[model samples]
Target: MEQDVFRLHYEATQARVEEALREQIGRMGRYADLREAMEYSLMAGGKRIRPVLVLESCRMCGGDPETALPFACAVEMIHTYSLIHDDLPAMDDDELRRGRPTNHMVYGEATAILAGDGLLTAAFQALTQADLTAQQRVDAVACLSLAAGPEGMVGGQAMDMAGEGRSLTRSELEQLQSLKTGALIAAAAELGCIAAGGSPEQREAVRRYAQCLGRAFQVQDDILDVTSTDEELGKPTGSDREKEKNTFVSLLGLERSRELVEELTAQAVAALDGFSSRDFLVWLANTLAQRTK
Candidate 1:
């Protein structure tokens, strides 16, 4: 019965995210050919996990999904920007994403770079445009900026680049993954609390939950990169091995990585114990840990 409720919620959230993506993208006007490229890449399929996190966290905090929609859209824009930049020639240099040609491959390197920049800027613009109180807007901006800026996602990306082709300690690898993958996820949940005018204690609880879930999500992603097929993953597998990047599976072996994912997922779910209305978040954390791709 619990599983059924979770599945229903997940499906509903997925549909909502899909609808939001289409509506948001439709609002992007054609300034030039670049706009087309941006839309093409933005509409490329993803699991919409981050946006759903935003909505679920907001709802758990007694906020309306409608009130959280802008923040949800903002986080997705940031995530899309990261994917665009990650696939550039100077980065991962992937030719495919979400089972289609990557942004750079389809739109040229320069245009893809510009598209990433556009999405990054647009993310903050969307957050600022949210229909919320002045304080809520301020909190949202601060949380998101920290997540996307040098101290968070960008810093993690730099660390990842630096760590490539080099062995790292378990602590070092975990730290890098936490920043690169977890920061924005944590920010998304925190943004939800902020949007709802949640208390500091409630916000902290959400942040802790997101931090653990982010780690679990990234570890599962690394595991899938090794075990899942491209069709199952909607993207190429074995890219981590190809790139010679440090991942949990590489550092800890597959069995140990799987164990760590379970551990982290449990910790993530545990963090929600203080919240009375965290059914959706608890389900999300467990689902992320158990996801096939």
Candidate 2:
């Protein structure tokens, strides 16, 4: 029953984010193909976890979740753009995403790159046009830039590429995942706190929560790639092993990776020690830890 309620809330949040994303894309004019490509990837179905974090964090911090809709949409856009690029031939070279052809696979590689660019720029555009205080917009943009920029996800990708075919220590692996996956997620939670006018201390607490949650998410992904079938993952599994990438499972073995996930989830939940209305976030962490098998 509790799981059902969490799913209901999660679905409701996902629906709200999708609606706003559609409305945001509708504002773009001309460049039919670009728009189509952008819409294709942007509308691709997923859990909308980042945007949900934004909304839920806002609510938990005593703000109107509705007012955070634009920021939430922007966060989702950034996340989608990253996924599109990550699937390109130059990156993970994936042909499928979210149970369908990847943007590059369908639209060709060049257009897929442009589509990613379009979504990235559109994220900032949405932020600039959102009904937010100037400071809020600035804070949100700064937060996202750090997460998505050279020192964050992109940097982590560079590190991952460099470290390929070579074994990595557990700390190195953790650092890579923190940047590659945890940065944007931490930004999502912090952006929510920013939207809610949360205190610096409160925002920092949520950031810690998101950072641990993000690391747990990647560890879980690593485990799933080894344990789950492609049909269950909606994309090719074992790509991690095929690519010889350093992962939690590769570094610490499957059982230890599972233990790490449990530890990370507990840390994430404990970070919200003082926040009211945090049961959903705690449940969300547990759900990710137990995503499959």
Candidate with the greatest TM-score versus the true structure? 2
What is the C-alpha lDDT profile of model 2 across 139-216, one tens digit per residue?
A: 889998889989998899899889988999889998998898899999999988999999998899999999999999
RMSD of each: 1.3, 1.2
Clashes of each: 0, 0
Q: lDDT of all the models against the reference?
A: 0.87, 0.90
Q: What TM-score, computed on C-alpha atoms, does each candidate reach?
A: 0.96, 0.97
Cα lDDT tens digits, model 1, 168-247, are 89999988987898999999999888888888988999999999999989889899999999999888899899889898
- Candidate 2, pairs of clashing residues: none
